[model samples]
Target: MVTTSTSVRSKSCLGPPSDMSPCGNWKVSIVTSDLPNAGTSSQIYIILYGQHRSSAPIYLYGTDRAPFQDGHEDIFTITVGDIGTLFKIRIGHTNSGLSPSWCCKEIQLWNMNSGKQFYIPVQRWMARDQEDGEICREFPILNKGQPILPVTVYEVHVATGELWNSGTVANVYISIYGEKGDTGSRQLFRSKNSFNFLRGQTDTFFLEAVHLGDLYKIIVGHDGLGPGNGWFLDDIVIRDPTTNREYAFFCHRWLDQEEDDGKIVRELYARDNSIIFARQKLEHNRKETWAAESWKFMKGNTLQFYNRLTGGFVRLHPDGTIDATGEKMDKYGFFDVIVSKGNICIFQSHEIRHLSLALDNGCVTGMASGRASTELRVVYQPNRCALLESVLVPGHTVIFDRHGKIASESAAGYADLSKEFVVFVKGMFLNNAVILLATSLCQALCLQPDGSCTGVGNQSEKSYWRVHKISSGICMFESVKNARMYLRIKDGQCDGTGTGDIDCHFKIKKNLENASVSLESTKSPGLFVGLQADGQAKPVIYTKNGNVFFYPRVIKCWHRVALLHNKMGMPSVSGALKRNR
Candidate 1:
């Protein structure tokens, strides 16, 4: 714990010691009193020892006065390294004609430990209230030690009677304090006549070579008053030296309402470790312009364009062609399409139903068939592909063709028929899991652990059905009855449940030339499928579960093929068929 004590003294000068001779040093003195006139000026001098041997004597004084006014006294303080040096003090007129009647009250000397030594013949002075001012014989001395650390000083004025000035300057008076770790001594660094002229609201006074173990205390008194009130005294601060880092604190204020009487205060932290404070002001209106011009591209016209940012996923028009430089649709989605005939179309992830396309404009108007349910008259356009009315049916399949036809259809039994094409069963299997088969003509066959194949030639065998492992697992079978396609389980495997019941998945081999397949199961289940392909895995149409499917790469012209089936129809083939043919 740290402690401090303040002693106020009234003195005229620090007199010389009785037995000691005056060495070559200087001394300073300060006196406080109330003056009679407002514009009166007084002169005080700091006497110097060995004045006859040295050059001209330098004199200084100390006082607390209103910085802006002319009548108040002036105060000065001088610092010296050696205490053995001697000094003297006296009072004289700056300009003889302008000198005011001044009085010298008492004389005292302050030592390194705040000890006081007095001079005889104590002087007296008239106080500000016209009363006899007491001559204090004691002076306080502040000691400077070692272990020098950083310091902060806050100077505050105590309000005695009423509030003072009312402008920004009146709020400048602040209290000074030190954090726990500063070891240097705090003393009167300077006593300027105009404290208001200081540049900042807070000023930093520095001391070097502070001793390692000593408590630092801040002495606060009246610096200089504003225009309204004179000088006064308040409180002081003493803090122990610490080794911790220092951070800054700030406060902000704003008016609460229309009246000035109400205000709000907020505190904010710095964004970065080093940044302390920042302020910004924004305007109400600012114009923003996009660089690219809006091209007058038609709705059905397909053009190709690339986004400079993301390089994936090319956009296509409703007519199954790439759309570039197209006008943005009604701010809802992009381009608007109108249906010409009572056809089917798929938009986004849903399918439309009863879909009748307008012959002139290609606007689709009809009731949409949802997943497992149906809805009222929904309007859509083949060009825009926007669903004007949609009633969502959870977990049900909704299909839409490119011609604007929408319907809800069952995907269970059709899974067999879907094997002939690249089937995309949106809502068939568990979410995030879908089964795509190359062909339905390739019969679905199961392999036993004994390396035996069953259900090879039978299409209506009940045992050749696709069975899932407890609703969460999907069973995938390769339909290449006589061709070899490399099969490898990328993740999850089937268990040895010959019932083909397992809670895992498998994958086809990446390179078909090896004629070797690998299997991994989520629960390690047995899987069986026929393999029949030449050294080169060329695309071909095969039968699986009595359905016909073809791998598009088998044909040189068609590079890829995908079969899509939803509730409405085969909308997946709409765009691809238009492109390939």
Candidate 2:
């Protein structure tokens, strides 16, 4: 049982006298529990008691970033006198704020100088209305040997269906439940995508919590506010980055007070079909690498968009108009999907030399190239045509009327093949392999020990690289020889290496209808990792032929083993220049 205390200790006698030596800094991590009214807005303080000396009350406060949130971990550092062998700690809060009750899960402390760690478990409520009504609590040192739960940042993808007023401006909140536990309801405030909760839009968000194991269900709702509070939720996909596992929940319903069930909240369960579809989607993407083809090649390529509703193909005209009237794949129905950048695609009409399909003020029309409205979100799926969603107009997708003419581009609807676009071409795959410049296939890109990146002629172990996914469509290439070094784009150059972090991640975009890939730095969006004719690596602005083509060389496991063995004094092929084929 936890020792409850109500006595207030005077601050004058809490610390060592002014003439003593400091005991060094301590890193403290406090974990809040997932209990009702567990987060406190009041000022919190803690006093450490040791066998030799005690510490003054240290206020647990930091910058404007709020801490002590429910089901969250807060870290702080404090310096005190020689407090040898910590035995107990007195922790409390000034009873303030609307809800002053707090539930502490545990407190972990690490002596920075000595490298000693101490854990104190306090799974109790220190509130006035409950648990003996004590505002202060004392926890003694207990070697419970319990491991703390690892925190994970979960990727959440929320899709709004194409329907009348399917989007809401109300504050949305979601809670995920799994076999282990549940993530407390967190507000879906900031979205990686622009403007959250819009009709026909899919917003991506990140929620950090203790690992909840395999997710089973989720509760999603909104605080019914704003002009249009009714929202039509299409579906949700949550991915655990650590295991690369995804949980899919299909909620083809309305979360509105005036809708079908007149409810503003809903609980959706994970479905097997959704999970399979997600996996298949990933697999299909992995199999196909994208690159921008030459204008000559792209102009000759014929792409088709099958309109399911009209049972026809999207046809283009010389007057820069688009219609879904082609009964079969013909010259008028042929187009080319040009991959611009990170999921942004352009559909260039083969019938019209400079005309491209675009979202024109909520209407699907033909437009000239270089227009911002021409950029669309064309999602590639397995065994199916690609889905075309508007990037300029958020959730709107391309659709055609029964008469075959282009309908509204702002349709809030579920994915349908009739509303899908497709283009088949030879692509590249560079997930995890040895990278070689297309011009110099013998030289392999490597991250050196001296924090420099360049292309080496020998395909040694240092030339191998592993791709680590940072976020959706973003990844970092880490050196297989030394995990700490990564191929990084910095200061407009890819000639330097860095410790794989957010700064090192690159937005990988595939060129449509080609066999090469572009690595655009997440830090500097337009800067790409480029190669020179002499096999040198650097950052460059992407162009048609600035030495950006890279070919992936598949190295067998046995080959790596043989190289290691040869290096370990076996009959070695020293000075032998092994060229990558």
Candidate 3:
């Protein structure tokens, strides 16, 4: 119990009275501003021993002055003490008999008891979102493509899951289904809390999974009693543990701006004038334009479009002339174009070729003989020779001659006796030189130095060589090595007259040997020359329709010759000489 005391003193000290206990404990004195009046009475009140009725009370004692109120002037000693076992103090009130109202200026309670004070500190409570704090939500899936681990899931509502009501759902229960023909049923997770309708309280559910397939579908449903019991899904996030990066598939919706809406509305501008305007603007602003395909710099300052599939350059210029310097451009399978100084150059295989305008020069001049040459040629020939003219086209086969005249000259056609044209000559003939010439029917003709020609008559039909005229008297003839000749003679008398009759004859010259002979096939019908080699003998004469007798040993001391020809019909000796060099 708690106690208090009050006391008052006068300006003058009063003498102590003798009416006190032997201990000399107290001499109560009262001090008043005036003498006691008959209508007003002053009393001194003291609390000797007291107990608090309901609570501890404080006692006050003071001297009362004249102008003071009824309870202000009388001097008294006040002390508070607890009498009862309970820790408390009480105040006393008394009525006076001398006056209509009794006034006690000072009051005191003597002998006060003390009590122990007890107190408790006040406490406050508040709540906040988990994410709003330092804590973050745990990602569910782990090693999605690998083996799965045991999983624990918790359900949460989207509205309350986020600290800011980000309207996001975290770890919410989701039902997933497998693809078609799946043998297993869909799996489900549940929420941890339920909503209260009366208090309008709501709860969120959190879901977790150990592993997810490459493809899966999720189904959501509501279990609450609210009108809209559907799942509240907002921002769904995925996180990779290895990288610790969070990814979201959803983005916040934004209002469409007027410019964006106009662009959308004009999406079909590609077919309208707006697209043309946009393209013009884009081109004007663009620094450069890229070529669609590879190109090469051809002759006459022209860019050639290279065709990768064909391994050729498409001539962009009208003339389609590929320059000799840029011929290496064909090596590249693809190429691009570069512009410099307002001129186009093709960049291919790390090489650059400047383009130039194509000239209308009729033909490419100064081309070496027997090499490929192209020129523009105007063909003018007789109607009979027009067959050759029709075969040539400008920029391809028909080209201007060395005289700068457009000529219809080609080495490929048959020789024409009536016209002159530039011919792509591959071979030439020299005077007094022996050369093998093949006829239109592929028969080989051996032209002699004397302008006379001899051949095995139509070997394709097995026709043997029948000499019609041999110089009158014995004329010396040398047989070529590895060459054979067959001759048939006509019956004739000593008078230089002959009866026309022929027979088959064949002969072969032995290898590595040359033979000489002076003979005439028209001399006798039975004239036969048999040259034998390699154990094989050939009869020089055989009766075709009739036969007559002739001297058998007239051609003594003469041997046949054998000739070996190569694929080109040139003598094997010539081919061996060429290879030896």
TM-score of every model? 0.19, 0.32, 0.15
Top TM-score model: 2
Q: What does each candidate score in C-alpha RMSD? A: 30.2, 23.2, 48.3
Each model's total of backbone clashes: 89, 9, 45
In candidate 1, position 327 carries an lDDT of 23
lDDT of 2 by residue, 217-257 (tens): 99999999997777879789999987788888878678989
How many pairs of residues in model 3 come into backbone collision? 45
Q: Which scores greater on lDDT, model 1 or model 3?
A: 1
> Candidate order by lDDT, highest to lowest?
2, 1, 3
lDDT of 3 by residue, 33-80 (tens): 222431133232222211222122222333233321322233233222
Predicted structure with the largest lDDT when compared to the true one: 2
